[model samples]
Target chain A: MKVEQILHMIGGVGGNSYANNSKLQEKAILKTKPMVEEAISDICNTIHTNNIVVADLGCSSGPNTLLVLSHISNAIEKHYCQYNRKQPEIQYFFNDLPSNDFNSIFQLLMLYEEQLRENKAADYVNLYAVGLPGSFYGRLFPTKTVHFFHSSYSLMWLTQVPQGLDEKNCAQLNKGNIYIADASSSIVYHLYLNQFKKDFSKFLRSRSKELIFGGKMVLSFLGRKNSPAFGDIFNFWSLLADALNSMISEGLVEEAKVNTFNLPFYAPLMEEVKSIIEMEGSFHVGQTQTFESNWDPFDDSTDNFVINSTLSGQNVAKYIRAVLEPLLISHFGDDIIEDLFSRYAQNIARHISIEKAKIVVLILVLKLKE
Target chain B: MKVEQILHMIGGVGGNSYANNSKLQEKAILKTKPMVEEAISDICNTIHTNNIVVADLGCSSGPNTLLVLSHISNAIEKHYCQYNRKQPEIQYFFNDLPSNDFNSIFQLLMLYEEQLRENKAADYVNLYAVGLPGSFYGRLFPTKTVHFFHSSYSLMWLTQVPQGLDEKNCAQLNKGNIYIADASSSIVYHLYLNQFKKDFSKFLRSRSKELIFGGKMVLSFLGRKNSPAFGDIFNFWSLLADALNSMISEGLVEEAKVNTFNLPFYAPLMEEVKSIIEMEGSFHVGQTQTFESNWDPFDDSTDNFVINSTLSGQNVAKYIRAVLEPLLISHFGDDIIEDLFSRYAQNIARHISIEKAKIVVLILVLKLKE
Candidate 1:
């Protein structure tokens, strides 16, 4: 599938206006500053060079990407000043699906132009930012040409959901709900694993070919402790799907249209990701840390909502739609989609306490082999 | 308590004699021969001496102990034969509660005397089998004296049925069969763990002190993957207990006394056992394996009446006196004990299948430190 179509199916920025809003973007950028600082320090130590090339995969149009890039720029400038040396040149690549709002990213760059110019260190820091629209899995840059690569909350999106859902054995039948049956579930999981392996191995192989002997890569993404079975979050989703299916069965909406759509992502476990990297053997692992974020604003404390929403607000509406749409229709009827949305909002208001939604993020820093 | 009194409370080896009888003993010995061979080989490779001191803890009365001792004797003989060296000077200690039928064990020893003579390995193997009359927790042998230690199907029995009956708890209120109340259950479990820790730690300290460097110890016992509430099991037993209590309330039998009763034993999980050993740091781990045994006889092609009768026959009578007597007197009047026993036996004969009583056994081998 084309990257744009997949992004649309997964309801990223272009599909969810609330998620695409600038307020949320600013919040995410602020939250990501610390991480960017750490990644820059590590990369600088590894390269021992004033110059750096960094790319943020899935850098959807928003203030967050620029904010992170700015931190990297500042770190490099600080290093140059401390060493009494000229600032190193920086080439920044902002990557995302082709459908992402590059216009917004461009506008954000212009908004920061004055601040970039005012910092006299900016003279030492030659910053170049470009939008690279493509799947991060395949070659987005020249082999070994990049110094640091980072992605957050993006790798989890599967290329496509498995097919043949209506057929028996294609789906698990439980109390009023249908799940991707075991056979299909395993098939989908392995398919994702294979794709990840192939893409990541290629990325590493390309890095090995292009990167200088001591380049480093840092990546962060959503992950789980164990493999995602059909029963877990999907079970909740399946309940929603069943609710939608019931709506169709009762003549509430178009069945063919619903069946045509599928979720475009997969959230793999941290161990699985580690295994893939280790098995490929392209980079030496430097460090890994997994942390959770509290996202829902309804029931969460104001501070947690403010912090986590900055990181996750844009994705929340899409996540609910992907997971709960089917169940809403199946149980509450498609006619009530708007009502369900309101109900969802109400539920969030009632129970969305800070730290209620747990998001496990695994960050891995690797040193490129010479 | 005196071993005899303890034995009386354990149904006097009448109901579940497979745990204590000769035919079963022979099978266990035969089944375990390969493992014994491997253990002996490993031991011999590490220690060059032709002399060894072995103790079998929880050695029940009868031919089982004899059969195991013989296997040990044979392993030593084979080791020497292959090496073209003198047979090991072996000292075998058969240990059990004092109430165990020492007479039966003595008879089995007599039966093996002629066999040992015919092999002419008897002179080389100085077998000194002794009955340990108290708990195995305290020091049972001299320091720096033992070479090998083994125990099977003995660790599961708690030192005593958890005290504090009549205390209010969920398990008690529900009167769940075979399960104790929640608090009482966990309290009992912790009690057992504490006791096991103290006793096993002492046993290990004493054993480590007594055993020569490179001594081997193998222990096998029943264990669980997850600890269940006492109420679950107590609820089951309580039903039976209540039935008996009802009989007493109805004045059909004299007040039933349950003093000195002991719970059937099972070992903790392999991890638990390993942790205990590791904490002591007295010995290094060699190997660990878990094996499951078929306990229910109904599924067996052969009639297990002889075995079952030996193990449960005595318990059968006590069960009636404790539970059925009271239940029958209160519900069915005075003369129902005999009638109920017949009915109970018939029901067991019809429904007691071998698959129902499967037990898991974990075996661990440890080597004494130099």
Candidate 2:
């Protein structure tokens, strides 16, 4: 099936079922809380409508979806409160793939609404919410319907595995690996780069049409600071590739299958993102900043509940598995998953003990100048 | 895991996975289309608000959820056009269990909204929808927020199975069956009756608090004709019981397990319904109707698409399975399900061939006196 479909099935958390392990996502959101508030204020300043329409593209439902809503609602209310102006009603659009756990989101919304009422904050802002399920690569809303949007850890997903890199289309050019690495063929790298360009441009074009002229969107996703080829970003994938490569000799996985399986993801640099927006989108970048984060956000001793074991590598592996398992399972069969990830965790622990992998996330606030 | 949790996990159907098997629900909804239209007309005629807040309690996701929305939107708009009144914006709240497939609902809603825009009907209705995920027997919205409510083929499900009827509570009060039947003891019948009274009354109390004084609610659910004692209401469950009883002989399932596993449902008569409404609910019944549908809506050749396989019994079994499978799978191990259902189809076929089994659905339009 499609990746969107797969994401929905495996998405959520520590729960045994379909929960996506989203704790790391929670940490990223916390770090970007101030940016979220700024974006809300920016939109409130520009939009003069009786109702504010806010869309959180690629919003996975659960505690985080509600958390985003609460923040948006509070910031907008505060904007009005500061000026002694009545806050406009809010129309929250939570956009996710068609397979998202909207049930959890909706239920969580009800609880959040109750919390607001209890806190006497509900009357300050009339809020309504709905889930919009579709890909952000194309138009999902009517023209001028959305005024503000927020997406984090989502835009990095390319439209699909780059077309020519698939085994069906070409000879697994990126042999014995599933993602970009220093050793991958130049053609493999180009295909991935071209896919990112096409997908990001399409995303920009679609959002430009959906958002009003003065609308604002704040996005934070995995990115490379100085350049898109930073090795730290790929080290996690590199170890996973090594684990898969080890299995190849044991006949656990086909080398051709590994070569064809490129992740539909790209971590763009700040400059690359800025250029893309200028050329492809109707918006101008108001601000761009990169945050350097430890590859394991929960590595802190205080929050060891997530990764109870002493082995930080296994903890990181579990976190990554929660995300990449569905994608890997689709490309390779289920039988190889256990051994592959075990090997990956061992390799990562060996490396992390020496030097922890680091990731630089680029956060951008954009304004619709046109 | 709890059945409710399990239901949330395994619900939904189709290529993407986790999609609800709602084909039978579609057929029942189609049959009730005119009734829905009538209810919508009645509500629109009496209520006037800046924005009409409507709640469809027990609204299942998929094509039917959209179908209900379309009918509701059309009826409200038609009312305004006929009276030359300014059409109020519509805020739709689709309420269902937390386990419902709201992802499908959201995706389908996006498509429906597009079709509306394409037809230029979007301007007529400033429609907004949000999912309300909770049991309808409790408060789901703010006080006076909702002006009207609609429910169909729901409410028959009791809030929870009767308290003392469980195997642990009593001696499997209604053994050899999953519901009330002639074979069941008077204690079993009374337990179901009391439970329905409690659940329906709680439902009314919750909704009363949520809606304005003049707010109206329309409900249609499985019911029997003349009186609650009519065996036709229980006949379906009886056949299912027989299928399980057969399994006891073959050692496929535990007899006590089937005995203790009564479905959390009740189908009442018009007289019984009125008595409860008068005693418990604050609203007065404006109109009462009973639709006598074949136990199999597809019994007629014209509507055979729903059950194409020439066996009416099998068709009914499938319909029931789509709805009750999650619940059954939770209670009885999945091993005996297929065999049990196959036997159920065989037994039901025998009964239907002799005289097509029938169901009486009671639809009531209720209004709260100011």
Candidate 3:
């Protein structure tokens, strides 16, 4: 089964996939704050209403789920208060996959609301929050109900692994690699691109319906620039391939297995994103800004991602493992995941020590076409 | 709006309701395990199905929520292994109000599942857990789907604070007190009794429909026994009333406010429970046992509740405040909650210092009536 079906299924209950190693994701939330506040500030100036609905699409369960809500609320409140306008009732719709850790989100939401209510010293802040558990690849709300939509580091996920990589379609099409590596065939690249086009178009199509006219969405996620350097998307996947290659060499896993497996992921370049938005014809897309974050998950530094000489590749490996292990385990089995990630971390650290490694995130603020 | 409607409203999010003060509730969970396991053991033997669905109704968001599920799972596993039978897949449904911190439960659920899977040494477990967010007083699951049921320390909440004590009906039906106090009239007692009867009967009716034939349920909740000499429901409410009396004398709060206010709580008498079970006729009611706990929320001693000589009534008052402060604040205002609970604690300390105080909890194991 693909990700949509097997979500929280194999990792079942204990899988540390998202809940355990969410530090990098937390950093992603932090890095995107300016873009988020910028979008909110613009919306506050233009979108005048007594009721404001803010949706955090693909808002996976964790400390980060409620972070964006508070930021948006504060920004909106700040703008209204500065102008001496009555603050509208803010309704926060925290949307995530049904498998996302919503229980934790709800628990934290209460605690957050408690803190907000106390700080505001109001009987009620007129803030309402609810969990909409479903896939963001499809529609999730009453049409035109949502005003502000925010997502970070989630658009990289394709609805499913590219259509043809398994034995069901071919014999290890992307040989000795689970995702795009430097050695991958032209066919693999094209297949992934086609899948990305389909998924991104569907994503745009779905979101376009839910957001109100002129509503703003800040979309930031892992993507590629043309330069496939050691620190970019190309290197990240290549390093992971490097880890799997060691496993294959050690005979821990069949080379055939790695060849057959493919990640349900695709990193779009800025040009590709522009083409899709132009091709889709739904959004007045704003200028896309490229952001560079550290491969080191531990690096909470909002400053430039300077790879400290002491920092090992394991930090990046841990971050990748936290997000990707579940899918890997689903394909390669649990026996290989720990060793694969450990070796992967070492490989990444070795490479990055020689060269600065970074992940490129593409941030775009889209306004629904009036 | 009643307790069910306003929930965290008047008390505001800053208010420390049962959801906030879960350590004591965790203590309640700890104090009532043998009974829980006993019921589980009996069900494991009697209910022979390939699948077992266990539902924890009123499973408030806290550290203790996932505890009960683990205890039930381990006990079932133990029972089946002892009999040389294959263990069935257990589906756990964590049910609570939409407002309950379900996020904590879900987050903890994964951690718990991870621990269980590790302990069992199984690559994958047959267990499935899902959050069922709704009220337990109504239909929650597929009819006749749930096999075993458990609820702890939550049934005391009468769906709405016994009707007619509000301004809409009249001025202070139960004069000079909030709950059933020594100063309360006969009508006040009867109103609470009738409300409890209705709510409990509805609870049984709802569960009876959901549970399979011969399915068993273990319910442990706050109640009162006839031996109301020193420590019982009698003094707990009276102590709270004493605090309010002191407040009235201080002129900090209007006596009319105290007279008009009432708690959305009812401590069922053992006889009252027995009669309700017999009257409902849905379950073959088993022997009902009464357990007493110290007014001090910290006391987990199963041995007779020995009130510490130095323990002031404030100890008990604090415990009550932690659980009931939200409801009281809703009836009164935020300004009085802190001061009201402070005086309540002092009054309770003074009263209980002269006399011992304890809380009575009634435990019952019910079998679906054939």
Give the per-residue lDDT of model 1 (tens digit) for B96-204. 5544544345445645754766777543324434334334654455445577887765655544333332233323422322223343445555645665666567667
Which candidate number maximizes DockQ? 2
For candidate 2, write residues B1-370 as lDDT tens digits: 2333444323455532223444445555666667666766776777666578788888876666777788787888888888898876787878787778786687777678768778885344367676666678766665566777888778888777786785454645777878888777888889988989998998988788777766778788888885445567788888889999889978988877877788788888788889988897488888777766666645544332334333777667776776777788788978887888889888887776666566777788888856
Q: Candidate 3: which pairs clash?
A: A103-B102, A103-B103, A103-B104, A104-B103, A313-A349, B313-B348, B313-B349, B314-B349
> Would you give me the overall lDDT of model 1?
0.53
Q: Identify the runs in model 3 with alpha carbons over 4 angstroms from their true place.
A: A7-20, A227-231, A300-311, B1-370
Docking class of 1: incorrect
lDDT of 2 at A331: 70
What TM-score applies to chain A of candidate 1? 0.73
Question: Which digits, one per residue and each the tens of the lDDT, describe model 3 over residues B1-370?
Answer: 5455445311112335444455556666776678777887887777787678788888876556778887888888888889999877776777676556555555556567668768776644556565665557765655576788989888888788676665545555677766777666777778888888988999999899778886788888988776322236767777678778788898888887777777778887788888998999998877567777667666666554345634544455555666665566666777877787777767666665665567778888898877
Per-candidate DockQ vs. reference = 0.00, 0.21, 0.06
Ranking by TM-score: 2, 3, 1
Q: Please give the C-alpha DockQ score of model 1.
A: 0.00
* Per-model CA lDDT versus the true structure: 0.53, 0.74, 0.72
Q: lDDT-based ranking, best first?
A: 2, 3, 1
Backbone clash pairs for candidate 2 read A11-A20, A12-A19, A12-A20, A13-A19, A13-A20, B12-B19, B12-B20, B13-B19, B13-B20
